[model samples]
Target: MPDATFKIFRGDRDGGELYEYKVPIAPGMVVLDALHYIQAHDAPDLAVRWNCKAGKCGSCSAEVNGRPRLTCKTRLDALPLDQPITVQPMKSFPVLKDLVTDVSWNYRVNKKIPPFTPRPNVEWKMDQREVDRVQEFRKCIECFLCQNVCHVLRDHEKQEQFGGPRFFVRIAGLEMHPLDGLSRTELLKEELGIGLCNITKCCTEVCPEDIHITDNAIIPLKERVVDDFYDPVRWFLRKLSGKKH
Candidate 1:
């Protein structure tokens, strides 16, 4: 019924530029559909990474109008159809090709996090209610949109030191568990770089899964780090107990 122009970024590891393609628009269509149309008719070589069109897949992450969002979930109706929709590859990682970014950095960061370690119990069980608390975070499909939107990684390029928002959510989910045995407070502060997050809550806004990354994950880790190392009363109590800081 209508037509729209997509201003898409295209290129490889060396560099890239925005390329525009006008395509017919249909009702209830998403950005991913538009990209597919371009690839089908106009730009056969346009490279984009995606697995499932449904929201559950978390495969279609990109910057739509400079905001991190899953392309499959972003409908055309919500955007200003009069203007060319700008779709760019995520800024946090190396761009492999048009709209496809090398998300391997996230895998490296994930490795730095301690694997889920449950306390040694011949019989391992806990309150289902306790398990329910971390379930929302487990819903993360590893889209890394939250990581892309984070200012630390987006603007500052802190990829070397900071593990990004997704990992913070990972750490928060595991640390909050009632049965998990790994205390990562020291590691959180020192190695994983939880201290870099300023609690801007930007990550929570872009989550398609609706996970409370800032309040539930980062803040709790911040509090844990403070209590473990910086709390004066806790420090004095530990000193009285002849514990090392």
Candidate 2:
């Protein structure tokens, strides 16, 4: 019924600025709807990305009032409308234009991890509990909000080093699979740089799927890396035996 002001970021990778707009609010309106209104009424050049506005596609992710969220799922009334609703592209990725970012780096990191390969000559059968464990990680919609919130990726700019939480969840799904034979500990340690995580749980908090990126995925993977590389007794034994596996 009343007009709400929005400070939406506009620009390319080289430069940008938050531009203000006024849109009349409607009952049960979401932030995405407001942005669409702005596009129709004010700035036709406004760039934002969305597909399934029902929140299943995860394509509408953006920082609303500086918090990573799916704009389609974020309710306008939930925010303080008296203040300008600040919407910006995810800080973790380079901006392509407006709220759409270049997320191709996430794909490239994903390709580095090995695909799921079942153990040779083993039964394909698995317990329901095991299936349930990996199933949690599988719920991810690739919103990349977890990745965007990760300080290792967002603050430290470890794109060349860390795989971020999304891939860690993927690696966790593979590593925890009952039939999966291949070991990604080496890959996790060397390339993905799981050690750099520091168990902040920032990734876990932002995940739209409610996947436990820290407790279920990252901590266990960290433990495996520590055992494989950092255990002093094991290292000593390996040196004594002069064996490399």
Candidate 3:
């Protein structure tokens, strides 16, 4: 309906600055559309990673007005257009160029998690409720918006120590699978650093899938970690049996 001012970051991993562009607004126009307009009319060299503009692909993620969100899903009308809308790369990862960030670290962390291993001679049939429980986790699109909003990765830069909320969700899916046989409690304790999360629910707030990352996935996983590593009776049993968790 009217022209909107956009301040988009333009640069590489070394550094960058916000470049302002004026775009004419349209009904039902999302932030990604505005970015596409900028690419067409103004900065042709602008680098943006996007696949499905319908918001399912999760490739069009960026911080809009200082919030981690999928640009494809963020309607311009929802933002305060009176001020310049700022679109920038996810802060937790290394910026590749413009709105693209190096999220390869997440892949490396993912590689550490063991795959779903069905219990020996287990029946393939599972309760519908159990199936539904793990199904919630399958909705993760790997947008990394949750990872970007997490304080451990964003503020403390604990990429080496902590696996952000995204992987915790992954681990939860594997751990909660009824027929799956695996204990990732040890991985959560030492490698993934689940203790670092204080359950602020910041990651949950930014999730595009509306996955209950803190309540359903993370909290249950944390309890499992405590039961495996911190339960007094279990600890004694492990000690008596000459076993280490």
Candidate 4:
């Protein structure tokens, strides 16, 4: 409708500065479109990580209007485009130059998850009813938007201790397996630091797939961890049985 000014943060692990750019507005342009136009015409050096601009790939995640959102999916018309649009790299990760944050940390954390080691020689055949539970986890596109919005990692900078919400979905898919039974609650509690999440649901708010990241995934795992370690009745039963589950 009118001219739009973008105050974009530009820089990296070493150092950088915020640069402003003006671009003519169109009827139905998204934020990603504007960034691409700027990169093509004005700022050729703009380093942004975006692929599958249809919002399937989660690479182009950044803070739009100070909220962690996928740029490709956010429409400019949805915002107050009459003013300067502030676009910045996700604060949770190291800036890699202009709107692109180093998300390699997510891949590193993903490696720590134990693989689904199914039982020995057990012919695994799951009914749709049983398979339906884990299918919800399939909706996740590995967009680290949830990871960035999580205050434990974003604000408090607890990546060394807390794994963030993305892994909760990861752990949930594995831990909830009907046949593949492994006690990761201990690993989640001690090694991975699941206790750091305070159920703020910030992760849920930014999820593009609308997966119940807190209620369905993280909270259930937390309850399981509590039942395993903290429940007095379960502790007594385990002691009497002389067995650990």
Highest TM-score model number: 3
lDDT of 4: 0.87
> What TM-score goes with each of the models?
0.96, 0.95, 0.97, 0.96
Error of 4 at 10 (Å): 1.2
Mind giving the per-residue lDDT tens digits that candidate 4 earns over 110-201?
88888887877767788788789988887898879999899999889988888889998989999888778667888899867999999999
Better of 2 and 4 by lDDT: 2
- Pitting candidate 2 against candidate 3, the one with the higher TM-score is 3
Clashing pairs in 1: none
Model 4 bad stretches (over 4 Å): none
Candidates 2 and 4, the one with greater TM-score: 4
Give one clash count per candidate, in the order shown: 0, 0, 0, 0
Q: What is the lDDT of residue 24 in candidate 1?
A: 94
Q: Compose the digit string of candidate 1's lDDT tens values, residues 108-150.
A: 9888888888878825767899889899789898999999999
Error of 4 at 85 (Å): 0.7
Alpha-carbon shift of residue 125 in model 4 (angstroms): 1.1
Best candidate, lDDT: 3
Clash count, candidate 2: 0
Q: lDDT (CA) for every model shown?
A: 0.89, 0.92, 0.95, 0.87
In angstroms, what RMSD does candidate 4 have relative to the true structure? 1.3
- Looking at model 2, the pairs that clash are none
RMSD for each of the candidates: 1.4, 1.7, 1.3, 1.3
